[model samples]
Target: MRALRRWWHDTAGDLPATFWYLWAGILINRAGAFAMLFLSLYLTEARGASEALAGAVVGAYGAGGAVGVLLGGVLADRWGRRATLLTAHLVTAGLMVALALSRHLLLIAVLSALVGVVHSMPSPAFVASIVDMVPEQRRSRAFNLQFWAFNLGMAVASLLAGVLAEASYLALFLVDAGATLATALVIAWKVPETLRRPARTPRGVPRIGSTARSARRPGLLTALTDRIFLTFVGLTFVLAVLTMQTSTIMPLAMRADGLEPSAYGLVVALGGALIVLGQLFVPRLIDRRRKGFVLATSTGLMAVGFGALAVADELAVYLGAAVIWTVGSMLAAPPNAQINADLAPPELRARYQSVFYLTFPAASFVAPTLGGVSLQYLGSAHWLVVGGLGLLAAVGHLLAGPARERRVAALLRGTRNGRPATSASGPMPAGGPEVATDPVRT
Candidate 1:
């Protein structure tokens, strides 16, 4: 008991107070995150929409999210994190209420998309704030704890959403909106702006230290242009596609094998259980390892797990596969965030994060489409393809290690030297190049 207490203390201790407030806000917000989860059902059951229209509306939401994240990152950099987060949260709450009260199909669809946009806009800001506040040495643990909080909140939401939905779909919307408002209030009351503003010269030019505007202001395109960082983003997209198979293809495969929906639900629940329970321990296990090695190991585990799905027919076999991939997920979460943080310049951190955030929406679209095609054509062989992708990602992470390390070292050196930092590709030249001054609320 004493040892367990010590471990708990060590795992959860030492993060800044503001981070804890942010963490608490995350927990509160996610605990009522139900709109997307039940959107289709609400459309069909309450609004009497056709399945095709419902699906389209959901797709529109996702598309809006893709746009939202990029916009959010830029806003976080320009308007400040506190303002962007507050605006997004409040806007999200308003949209949720508007969605519930909305009756027209077109209006409903538009509201859904708006909700997606506002809700997703905060992601880059949240991650960028974490990176800004937490020191590099403790980031792994900080990210792990943050990830754990996310999963924990999600678990509660899943359970509470069902209960709330039983009362009325209105409850879901109202509760989600209320929770979002709560998050906004928390940020307004507790969280301060974390974005480091560049000092201005007497002539009113933004400059970093003695460099006097050495690097051009990094725009969203900068992240896309950095070859090394782009490589990392691409690999992460592959990982997202692989990870998505659990929700997209796994159940379909199981149903084909004659397992009941209950069994499938149980299997998925088990994976969620493992994550909520086991993720906190992972930082301690992998924090000391090279980021490349940790990522490689994680992808390898995923490869093995998803590959085993090729033969997973029985309940036991399915549970075993869940265990394997869940373990991989535990390993991957912290390092993924850490590396993303490591690669981002302070000026462009949110933009880089937004680019990284794009992977999930992209993967969500790609995975189901590709997985369906693969299952139809390749049958069980689809799992093999999934496994192969995981292995490819693992290999990519390993090969990218040396370059990534050097880039991180360079970034650290530049920061320590108090100069404008360069990105992974190379030195960015002086003065403004295509700097975007237009604003959008995250």
Candidate 2:
């Protein structure tokens, strides 16, 4: 108890208003997502939709998310973070209300897409806000705190939603809509702007754009074309594929094994509980380590966990697999953001984050459909195939050895040479710090 007290005291600090506001909003919004707990069941049992149709509706959400992420990045870069976030919440709130009122399949699909779009809009801005508020050293801790808070909220929401669904599905939507409105209100009133714009040149001097055009230096597209950044994005794509298998197929597998809804709920609860506990220690374990090494190890652990799931039939075995995956998830969460933070210039941080985040929506788009198809065709053996793909992605990271180091070195060298240390074009110089060193604790 004394140690816990001391830890709390030491970690206490002022976080950005945006962080608290967003965290609160997440908690509220997630609490309302109780409907998601039974969305598949609702569509299949209540609404009488085909399995393929349900998958399409769910997958369409991902499609909308992809579009939202790209647009959000550009808007956050151009308009500012606060505005983008506020707009997203407002739009999402309306969509939730619409979804609650409608029953037509096509209308539901459209509303789901809108919900997905607005739901994703705040992510880039929110993540960029964290990067802006915290120092590099503490960034991982800060992100971990955010993840912990998010999962905690999710766990609560999932439980409550389940309870509410047993009462009324429409009630779940109404509750969720209310939460979204509350979130939007908090953002509008509490969150501050965090977007960092580029410095303007003197009136007589040619604009940086004109100069870059003359010099033939590459632009944002060219900078993103970097081998390391692209590699990380590719690996994240694979991780997304593996992780989605749990949400998409695991429940089906559990049902096949004779687990009831309550039992399946317990399994999800356990995973969330593990994440909350694991986040507490994972930051300390990876303290001051290279981001790449942390990421590689996490991905490898995830592969092992997924592989275990392929063979496990007993509930205890499934729980054990969840524990392994939870650890990997905790490790992977912070460093993923850290790497993107390292790669992006201060001015373009939000844009880079938005683009990097594209992988989530992209993978979401592919994973559900593929997982469904695989399960329909391959049955239980599909787990092996999915786990194998995760292992392959982990191996890819291993083969991409020292790429992070090389990228950092190049970034530092470019900075030292004063070669327009911008992210719109050009490579990061070498020999700089590999991981961000500041604590994001607040």
Candidate 3:
């Protein structure tokens, strides 16, 4: 018991109080995250829409999220983290309420898009806030704590989503909106803006290249121009599409097999529940391992999990696949966050996060649009195809392995040699980062 307590303190004891609130706030919101849980089911089962069109609606939501993430990154840099979060929550809350009242297919699609735009705009800013607060050496622990909280909330809400879905689908929408409203108020009361804008250079005056480059706050254009970073983003998109299938395609398959909405909900909730139970220990299990090997292992687990789903007709079979992929998702979560944090220059931290985050929405757009059509025509075999893509993505991770090992070695050497470690994002800032890091723990 004492040893466990000591580990917790070492991992999270020094984080700032603001981060605790951010952690708590997101937990509250995610606990009510029922909208997406039932979105696919609701559209088809309740609204009497065709599977293809339901996928389109879901895809539109993802398309809007991509736009939101891009716009959010710019706003997070140009404005501040607090403002971006508040705007996203408030607008998203209003839209969620409106969505519950509407039944028109076109309007639902449009609202889904708008809700997507407003709903996910806070993502980059939220992640940047964590990067700003946590130290580099311990960021894996920091992200693990945050993700643990998220999965804990999701486990409950996802299960509750099934319950609420069984009762009244509209109730899920209202609960979701209420949670966001409460979250907005909590943030307005507790959280402060963390992003720091760099000083603008005087026009026509030649500035030092290194200094100008250091201070130049990058945006969407600057982020996308990097070829290596784009490769990372593409790789993320592939894995995301495989993971995203549960939200759109898997439930449809289960329903086709005669399972009820609640059955799907309980099955899907296992993913979050497993993460909640195991995320903390999973990081420990992989500690000191090479990042490339860890990523490859994760993708392989997901490939197997999703591939197995092609043959899952029974409840136990579905639940088993959920456990496999959920562990993979948890194993990969912390390293992925650490990688992006390491990738961000102070001037471009939030925007870089936004760029990487593009994969979630990108996967959303691709998974549903393609998975929906494929499931319609190709039938259960579509899961096999999705599984193949997961494997291909795993192969991509392995191919990138040598370069990754070299990079990790160099960083280790630099740290041991009394030089500060650098990243693909370049040298760490001298002392003051984009946000203050003093711990406010009592």
Candidate 4:
């Protein structure tokens, strides 16, 4: 008990009031996140749309998200983080009501797309806000707390959604709208804007925000050219793909193997429960470990989890695999966020976050299509292939993790020496193109 108390205190110090509010707001929004989970069913069964049209409409939501994330990143940098979130949430609230009231297929589709646009636009800013709220050392713990709350809300929502979905989806939409609006109000009232805007700096004196502005930012294109960051994005996307397999393919495999739908639900709920309980414990325990080690371990667990399902027949076995992957997911997430935040300079913070946030939509867009195709073609053998892919991702992260550390350290060294940071190559000479400093992030 003494040891546990000490660890908890160490992992969680006093955070800002705004951070707590942010946490609460995120929890509320995620709890009512019922629409996307049930949208397909609503379109097809509830509204009597053809499968193809329903798919197109669903696709519209995702398309909007893809666009929204990019737009959100720009908006965060251009406007402020709190402002961007306020706008996004307000619009999302309005759209949820509009979607609930929407009866005609055309109107529903348009509103859905619009909803997607605003709905996803807040992601980069939201993550950025968390980073801004916490100090360097507590970032992983902060992110883990946020991540845990998100999944907790999701788990609760998933359970309630089925029960509520049986009655009226309108109730679901209204609740969702209410929660989002309340969250918007919380941000509008409580959370301060965190984005550093460009302002005129004196010739010699350096203001903090001004220094952020003067970092010779190469814009989104320049951010894209960042070798270490780009590599991180690629690896994150791969991890997202593995995660998608759990959602898309795992269910299909379970049903194909004669397990009931409830079996999958039970497995998912159990996984969520594990995350809610273990998220805080795992990251704190492993906080001292290298990011690469965490990433590698996560990928290895994913490989093993999926590999286990490929052979297991019992529900017990399936649930065991679920637990393994859930722990793996929790372990990898905070480090990933920490790394992304570390990679960006204050000037390019939002844009870098947006680019990093691109992994989700990118993975979302690709994963379903690819997994569906693979499952359809490979029949029973696809799980093994996925496990093999996870193994490859593990190897990739192990290699990339160390390489990322080297680059960040070198960049920090360069910055301390009054030189701009170099790319992921050898030691940069003085006055070389400078990079923003990032030490031990990711």
Number of backbone collisions per candidate, in order?
Answer: 0, 24, 0, 4
- The TM-scores, one per candidate, come to 0.82, 0.87, 0.90, 0.84
Off by over 4 Å in 2: 1-6, 9-14, 202-224, 312-314, 409-419, 422-425, 428-442
Per-residue lDDT tens digits of candidate 3, residues 47-91?
Answer: 999999999999999999999998888788788889999999999
Winner on lDDT (2 vs 4): 4
Stretches off by above 4 angstroms in model 3 are 199-218, 405-442
**Model 3 residue 288 lDDT score:** 80
lDDT of 1: 0.77
What is the TM-score (0 to 1) of candidate 1? 0.82
Using lDDT as the measure, which candidate wins? 3
What's the TM for model 4? 0.84
Better of 3 and 4 by lDDT: 3
Q: Write the per-residue lDDT of candidate 4 for residues 119-216, one digit (tens) a residue.
A: 88889899888777787667777888888888898787767666666678898788888888988988888889876555876656533422222344
Report RMSD (Å) for each prediction in the order shown: 6.0, 5.1, 6.4, 4.3
Q: In candidate 4, residue 43 scores what lDDT?
A: 75
Question: Residue 181, candidate 2: how far off, in angstroms?
Answer: 1.7
1 or 3, greater by lDDT: 3
Comparison by TM-score, 1 against 2, better one:
2
lDDT, each prediction: 0.77, 0.68, 0.79, 0.74
- Identify the candidate with maximal TM-score: 3
Poorest lDDT segment (10 consecutive residues) of candidate 2: 433-442
